[model samples]
Target: MSSADQSHPSGNKPLGKRARQKIERPRAILAAALDEFMLKGFWAARVEDIAAKVGITKGTVYFYFDTKEKLFAETIRSFSPNLASESEPIDKNRPVREQLTTYLAVLYEAVAINPDAKRVFHLLISEGRHFPELLDQYFAEFLAPALDRITSLITSGIERGELKSTGLASSPEVLIGPAIVANLWGIVFADRHPRDIDAILTTSLDLFFRGLLE
Candidate 1:
């Protein structure tokens, strides 16, 4: 058999066009939904409009996600980081200051620098009251775990005499609040208030670590 024709390594054939389309249909729908949600808040967004963007019928969009609310939730989920899994594994041997700087850099990049994530944040702020369960899901699924990780990292640093034992360790949300604020600034001000996220992160970390380091 020709090398190109032989695909029996895993005893599975390449997916057919129809199969690939079926797999990708949901992702296309979700992307279109996010754009629609961003352009028009949740109340104004229409499933038909999202489906039109995806070149699919409204019923087809419904086939994958039954309701507009489910579609919006899933769209945010698709774009959001799986914080628990995505967090960089801390190197305990490294100085806590270095560890924190590296970790916070990643957090800031994800929350402040990413435009799509910022859009999702804006949507949540503006439209989340309409979907209380969606807000709860975001907190329970993403925010809670991320805060827990920060708290554990701080506690470890304190025990190792690397970080100061302060109220900040107990409330680790403060560590990431500035990143969220920067994200909000982007959403509210757009290009009018141009601030470099890298500079913001560097300065914020420097100030924060000065207070945190033992």
Candidate 2:
């Protein structure tokens, strides 16, 4: 029988016993795999290791993901929501600074809560030489949409005269890029020092607002 044909003690919920098992197995595997991958990294992480971590056989791991590359790709995809969700649309009628502040706060909270996920993300970015396709998928699926939304916000701010009439088309990058870099640096290097995140965000917004004011 296929893996989906197996039975589980978990109650039925539209999926057959085997299908539910199949659905749940990968989630369990991915949860364990993420922990292992974050601890050991993509190149060093082995399917056997992940299988042991998830109490499954190596063949079972392959059945779910087909390859280590696919597993890592999925792992990276998982981290992305933490970052991408920060860019959800804000009320356009809200004050520009308030909207920007909310965006930065969401980004900060996501990183703060998911440090391991962030570390895995950084590793992917730094060591993705052989996996350009994976990196491309990450950017296309997560980062690009977030950036587009931010850019749209900036454009709207300009059009509404809430921002300066500067010819800067990539205003979102100008506003957000430095903050992202700072957050990454702080997380990776600051030894978990008490950063006044509110102060930093306020200062950044102030600076951006000053530049954009008439």
Clashing pairs in 1: none
The list of candidate 2 runs beyond 4 A from truth reads 1-20, 82-92, 108-113, 190-199
Alpha-carbon shift of residue 35 in model 2 (angstroms) = 2.1
RMSD of 2: 5.3
Please give the lDDT score at residue 171 for candidate 1: 83
TM-score winner among the candidates? 1
Q: Residue-wise lDDT of candidate 1 within 39-102, one digit each (tens)?
A: 9888899899998998889999988998888899898888875556546666788887776667
What's the lDDT for all of these models?
Answer: 0.80, 0.68
User: Candidate 1 regions off by >4 Å?
Assistant: 1-11, 86-90
Candidate 1 — number of clashing residue pairs? 0
lDDT of 2 by residue, 1-214 (tens): 6655555556443457666767778988888888777667777878898999878899999998988988888777766544544565668669865776677556544443356555555666566887898778767875576567667666777788887666444744565555566556765666766576557766776776687775
Summing lDDT over every window of 10 consecutive residues in candidate 1, give the lowest-scoring window: 1-10
